[model samples]
Target: MTETDPVTAAPSGKGLDARLVVRRGSFRLDVELSAAPGDVVALLGPNGAGKTTALRALAGLTPLSEGGRLWLDGVRLDRTPPESRPVGVVFQDYLLFPHLSALDNIAFGPRCRGVPKAEARTQAAAWLERMGLAEFAGTRPRRLSGGQAQRVAVARALATRPRLLLLDEPLAALDARTRLDVRAQLRHHLADFEAVAVLVTHDPLDAMVLADRLVVVEDGRVVQEGGPSDIARGPRTDYIAQLVGLNLYRGEAEGHTVRLEAGPAITTTERLDGPVFVAFPPGAVTLHRDRPSGSSARNLWQCRVAGLETHGDQIRVDLTGELPLAADLTTVATAELGLRPGSSVWATVKAAQTHAYPA
Candidate 1:
């Protein structure tokens, strides 16, 4: 399914339905969003696209300008105060008090919600154990690692027993190595969360791994929304395509005939009709500075090498062809070809390496 596809959900009287309209100067955030119980939705976009603003609106940190509505399980909470709302928010920076222990940090929310101090601590302890942070419960935020702080933040949010959880760039603070481990850990916990979860992230990998659906906001408006795999497979906008960096094409496929809208047509292995998506990985494309003498490859486009960059030992050549595509070349091959920016080149991509699916 594509981003335009309608999502299905189990019948929930009112899980979380909100129309958030916030205006700052001339900039406006007008987003209509809904999620059923047990739904994990990710609000994904680049910086300054209002992903954070939307999350804040749902958490009641920002009031809407042109009227707003927020419902939680049939209850209209727009009129409710922030403290009275059942929403739980974990900020990008784990805002744990420096003086407080990891255990106390997790207990703070429940304590503020009127739970007994001892009971809240007990609850916090259980959550800490679940998050694999029980060993560091006595450690303060200043001493905790980035990944540890993130897990504690999550435990705090979940300890509130909220019907809706809001996570803002939960994994953005960790390094690459830590991110890999934390992402796996976070996915398991999110899967076990019984309530609706909405996370704001710019990382495609985080959105794809952590959530069931992605709601892409651009300049305060929802531009694309869909399941992660589908969006990865068929990106409608150039930004999405560039984010995933895949060669995307929109065309009609009848049986095995796949017509390219921008360049030469080709036959595909899939049988389809109407709107379809064709995608090819960057590594599948072969870059040549000269036009092919003779090749069995079905698709070849004469183009110019727009840019060259090194990814580890492999050189990634960006080609502006009859259609632009990214091609991966070895360091030795790049040195031998002497490929550079503005250099003429030819790109050859095998038909079997290209993939087509319903858009």
Candidate 2:
């Protein structure tokens, strides 16, 4: 079945409903998305996953292939020009006119929509004040800081009073410190917005923190769509599992044992009998210098260290052997074990540490 089949039974006519299809050479992007007013949906994926293509389709900046449809507030917009659509787009680079002041840059949108010059400036002033950039109204884009420039871009977008908002990597241009501050501010503004907002981003933390719902796209299709917490706890794809820092495997479960398709079996606390997925965090694994004996842990595997890297405050050990997986250890513990690329070690995990769910 198509992605929109389940949700298209009854169109509410008050929000966004779209089936974006774009074909480029051998690549085809077909993504279905629906959101109500006041809903913030994030399109998240790795590079070349069509996240940006979906965003462009929503903004009417890119034409859709045959059979594609786009509707916002019950209005057909697939054939409408970008300027005629009631959509506001904040590009990755802000795209502010360098010669225009902050106020003029924002006022330009309303003026183009035929609002009187004075009235458009008034609206721009209000947006600038709301965005806490009132004092920088006359400042040029080159003179403003990164966060300030982002706020101005958002204010400019809001000045148009669009029914749908599109942000393409809104924080991609900011520095690390500025990103945190802008992310918080952007979340607050999104919460207050009564329109449908779609954000395109590859950063997992940004998606989790700023969006009310996440749509994980890969290979031009929606791989998963759900709440951030749900996706974090039970990832369906290896890309998502790795993004959330979990070792995931598909297997068939019988009683308490899940036989992995790749070659090993994992003992889980849950009792099920069907195809299932097993997942555990790297922190749940313990590595020993030698084979552990008389251990209460139900799972053990002799592995060879394939690589080592620093992950935050812990050392992440990549292993390959009976069951390839990752384990996290402290630098001191790693030294004590004398672990290196070819070091042999035993890894153990209690049955309770693993989680299994239906495939």
Candidate 3:
């Protein structure tokens, strides 16, 4: 599939439109992705899903077996080698040389690009200061903390002044506490980069927080691609639904009636026709011990509780019966009902709470 630039008539500034296909024995990876200038797109997937392989292909480290098309700002890049590609790559490990200081690490790229030694050092110094690493400019990678090393990696990548920036798990090596601080800073840096930035990450929060759109990969293929809110609200696959934590259903809608594939019908406030998506977060679901005789709840289910797990102060109950659905309950209510793995329960959901939209 070809992805034409959305800003077709306008001048190509800092954007990437590329198609890659890599095959090795039995495993094959095909990716067709594009982003506008200043757009951050996240390539998200589980481990060994070829997310990293896709990034390497963009960087010219991996050869494409079928398609080798690459364009940056309307300029053909398919013939460009790794060193020749106007791209910056930040590895998962923040692969800085142990022999070099932070300043030297950032300077290395520009120097190799034929910039004067004095100018390269000056450029590197500016980047280090911008990244708040001036104090550690003289420090080696072995001496820097995980967060510091990551910032240095980004600074080094940006020093190359690339038109297309590729980041592979930029924050994966950081500790949990460091990740929060780094995430905010990284977002700010990406916005001001004036270039198309692509990030590969397995963490859902990382993708959602850093990217404008997400291209979800599964088993070496692009399965889903859309805006962050769109992906979160209507995850197409079970893996995606669990990643974003939303209940998703596929059904045909006529007016307000939605017939589920699993033999349960739901009525919603939304008015739509044809194939549609109905979604509700687990927290929106409420549980009851018994179905009310004349209840206001539009949707009711007599389900058996299959499992209960504590999620902080809330209890998440897994149920099976008419339809398998997850519901969130308070710890107090769970104990009040003496809820267990095999307890009988009733689930009530309001039509207004459920969202129904065209698929």
Please identify which of the two predictions, 1 or 2, would achieve the higher lDDT against the true structure. Answer: 2
Global lDDT of model 2: 0.93
Q: How accurate is candidate 3 locally (lDDT)?
A: 0.87
- Which scores higher on lDDT, 2 or 3? 2
Count clashing pairs, candidate 2. 0
| Cα-based lDDT at residue 115, candidate 1 | 96
Candidate that would win on lDDT: 2
Least well predicted 10-residue stretch by lDDT in candidate 3: 1-10
lDDT of 2 by residue, 176-253 (tens): 999999999999999999999999998999999999999999999999999999999899999999988999999999
Task: Provide the TM-score for each candidate, comma-separated.
Answer: 0.88, 0.95, 0.91
Order candidates by lDDT, high to low.
2, 3, 1
lDDT (C-alpha) at residue 280 in model 1: 81
CA lDDT of each prediction against the hidden true structure? 0.84, 0.93, 0.87
User: Local error of candidate 2 at 88, Å?
Assistant: 0.7
Best-fitting candidate, scored by TM-score: 2
